[model samples]
Target: MKRDINIFEFPLNLGLKKKEHEIEPGVRKLPDGFRKFDFHKEINPQNIFRLDAPDYSMEIDQESGVLNAEGIIEYAKEQADFISENHKEDAFNIILGGDCSILIGTALALKKLGNFGLFYLDGHTDFIPAHLSETAAAAGMDLAIITGTGHEKLTDIQGLKPYFLEENIYCAGNAETDDDEYVQQIIHSDIHYFDLYELRKNGFGKTAGDFLKMVYSKALDGFFIHLDVDVLSDELMPAVDSRMDDGIDYTNLREILKPLVHSPLCFGIEITVLNPDDDKAGSYTQPFVKNLIQIIKNKED
Candidate 1:
């Protein structure tokens, strides 16, 4: 029997540590934006599941990095439980997130089953510490928090510190790492990493081969993938929350992604930060979706 792909939609802007006024708009439209295109035919996923958080009452206390919401943690717990008990056991999960912060909830779900690694493919390191950031965007600090390296409260989500073991994580395809602090944090930490230049220098196949080798050698139960579309350079596909120049282009992206998407070791895949507002002409949608389906077919064959 053919295997299955289960897609999850998380539609909310609540996860930010950044004040709403400062955040770039149109992220909340991601889920809605996705609906404009026909993924049902394109990717042909088995089922699409959506996880919705309760209406936001969250406020950020910038000094300490707390979200300042009473119910948000509980909401995350519920989302985690839903993924673990219902969807995870049955299908290959594809999560469409409002922002990278969705990792906080989904990673917890992956953790519940067994220890899992992360394949973070994005433009920014998103390794900034919450306390150090006044923008307060949880999206920026997701990788840090996921690895249990950020503010105490976020690191300890559900009492699961170091939600993902550093040795098991591979942060591939990060661009624009010039920020001294973000670079410093990643350097001091144990997460396996490859910058855009490093990945391209070796080519996508070798990078994927080396990355998977490193991941499988550790012998973790499974791993989840996080794809921030901003990792693509503006020339090919520019519809993103943030753009990174001189990043991977479409051809190399497919080459880099195919093996991993096809890898048996991959448990779940999440796509985030595709801002529909940026792509009003729908010029980039279908081909991008098609490439994703082809990525999966690499595994199927």
Candidate 2:
């Protein structure tokens, strides 16, 4: 059956510390970036819906470099619940996020719906604790929080511990870096961690095929897809708070995502951490939006 695709936006920069190349995380300008694309005119209004999201900027913790994780959790939870309550079971969702921490609420909403898994694609493991957060971006800790590994406030959201089991999660394209110790944590944990290098070695198409099988086998209520823009190569997407020298390319991302999103078990998707400052003249936003449009359209067909 063809499903409705609704869009929601969370424009803020709750993550980021010092800038590189003065590359600030101006997530607040994300909606504006898309506006340049005139998304409303491009897609059919009958199939696309919009949400009246918060219209203000949130202050980041000067020392922590991330907005208060707990505080954002409370707010994001409400947004997720609202979508769950208002949308149909088959409605395909595309959430535009300020940062990856948005997953805490998304996972919680899935918890309320029933058993669900997570498909995480990013540049870093995001397993750092409060003390080990080198830049203090809560986005960096979202994965650990979703797995019920960190802070009680996040781990215990809606009284759901380990919201997504390690077996139910398939994290692809997480490139290694020397700046964080999260790599060691993933090596020791039960999470299905596939580095960008390994994915390329095994081939993204082959690995994505195998990964989807794993997710379907473990999922009772399907799964959610989280795409952190930083997963793409620095040369292609340098708009993130953290950049990796090597990573997945845009063409490779589409190949990996197309089949998985076409699966019946794929419930929704959230794309986060795209800094507009780096995307001058809608160069990146235009193509990104085009890909998403095709992805959503393919889901209905």
**Which candidate wins on TM-score?**
1
lDDT of 1 by residue, 190-297 (tens): 877788888788787887777788777878787788998888887766877667676777778778777777777778788887766677777876566666666765
Query: By summed lDDT, which 10 consecutive residues of candidate 1 come out lowest?
Result: 16-25
TM-score of candidate 2 versus the correct structure, residues matched by position: 0.87
lDDT score, residue 100, model 1? 78
> In lDDT terms, which candidate is top?
1
TM-scores for candidates 1 onward, in order: 0.89, 0.87
lDDT of 2 by residue, 134-222 (tens): 66567788888878776677677667887788777877888774544667877778888788777788887787788787876664678
- Cα displacement (Å) at residue 58, model 2: 8.7
Query: What is the total number of backbone clashes in candidate 1?
Result: 5
Q: List candidate 2 segments past 4 Å from native.
A: 18-24, 45-67, 299-301
Model 2 lDDT vs. the true structure? 0.71
